[model samples]
Target: MRTTNRPASGTVQSVDRAVTILELLAVHGTAGVTQLARELGVHKSTASRLVAALERRRLVEQVEDRGHYRLGVGVLKLAGATTARLDLAQEARPVCRRLAADTGETVNLAVLSGGAVLYVDQVSGTSTLSSYNWVGQHIPIHASSNGKVLVSELDGTELTRMLGELVAYTPSTVTDRALLEDELAQVRQRGFAVATDELDVGLTAVAAPVRDAHGDVVASVSVSGPSFRFDEARIAEILPLVRTATTEISSRLAHVPPER
Candidate 1:
């Protein structure tokens, strides 16, 4: 095999090659297995394997009627999360605070970062469940209410990629892939995701999707407290509040067309 600029150390070989394939697609629009192998200086089969992996992850997709591949909507989902962070910084802070005040529970603004939920902003309520600042924490995508809301938008292939191996965070956690799929379906149907003692024994959270102008789910807004304090009746009351906060944040984002 020949050589490329993929880092020689501190990276898995297959991962490096996969990323290089994406970079190649990004720069040149699209390429087939033969061209990609020639550019990567590797055997065609190796390049094909890398492409197949990316395709499985929805990071790359086959072009219509051609064997060439290009970047996929999954890439947009990752990139859109960054844009969501930027939009949320200014528009979502007050909404989070209001939700915290209304519900007296911790409120978090999270986006899908790879297969994890990256909490970007938080507001603490009167209920002190944990002092740990959730901001910048990467929570497993299969565990939290916020994660469920975020993944509800993913297609079947992307959903599989996000849920590689569901680690049981708690006994109540959904470990079966089919069950998790059902849960996400309910989230999409009802416009909310509820995790009751699923991520932590004493924790319960309810989340709603934050949409952009195009109505795509970009982030999730959640309100969480100890399960004891978040009974079925209590969750019922907070669900509307969570929905309202998400609606407010999404409306603000969609109110006006972005400048050029």
Candidate 2:
């Protein structure tokens, strides 16, 4: 609750405090009531109430045999809910299954939300040793194949705002805004994207954009796995399959728009 030099709007202030609390726990590992209150510039009772509210929602938890607190399972549930609420998940399930069966690699459905790609559904391939379980997680919009495919839908100004101060998630992640913008333009022209070890050290993914009836990019369909099984040639091979899956999903989605 530190006062901003320029006062924040009410909504912005609430969001800032919520994000600050999360950052505090991430950086300090564990914090007690008084210390957190002091750090946040709020009263001890107010901090306690915030902690108690977070605890009730499983976003924070009290440490055992200690007065400190840490992040809890509720955060994971909240993260998972992003995917669970998507109408695309139900509509795209059969298409994802077909893609997984054909490619023998995990098939994922993702949509762009708040400048990040949120996985809405996934179907695990029947490989002898499969990899990746990021179905209900958020990944950087500039670092993944699905991300680039979705980012292609944004206009120049909106894309620039979303890509502000990009962080490198991996050695190959494009943190340079100009370079990433160029790549996004290519993705727009090509109708697909291939990311090799851009997010994880040895992960590769091929994604195609999913468009609605009006031709707006609504989501992305991807096939992904470990680098050992997803090399350049393999990614190129799967691109067509991913495109086909996305096409099918798009056709199904065209008939059913979300209720406003």
lDDT of each: 0.88, 0.82
- Native-to-model Cα distance after best TM-score fit, residue 220 in candidate 1, in Å: 0.4
- Candidate 1, residues 1-260, lDDT tens digits: the string is 33456676644877888888888899889889999999888899999988998899899999994789999999999999667578776799999999998888999999888779999998999776565689999999889999999999789999988878999988999999999999999999999999989988988999999888888888899998888988999999999999999999988888433466
> Candidate 2 — which residues are off by over 4 angstroms?
1-85, 128-130, 255-260
State the local distance difference test value for candidate 2. Answer: 0.82
- In candidate 1, list every pair of residues with a backbone clash: none
lDDT, candidate 1, at 257: 30
Tens digits of per-residue lDDT for model 2 on 1-260? 45355346966655565567777888888889888878778788877877887788889888884779988888778777655446678888998998999988888889887778888888899872755677779888889999899878788888877666688888898988888888988998899998988998988889998887777887899888888988768877898898888888888767343467
Best by lDDT: 1
Cα displacement (angstroms), candidate 2, residue 7, comes to 25
What TM-score, computed on C-alpha atoms, does each candidate reach? 0.68, 0.65
lDDT over C-alpha atoms for residue 102 of model 2: 90
User: What TM-score does prediction 1 earn?
Assistant: 0.68
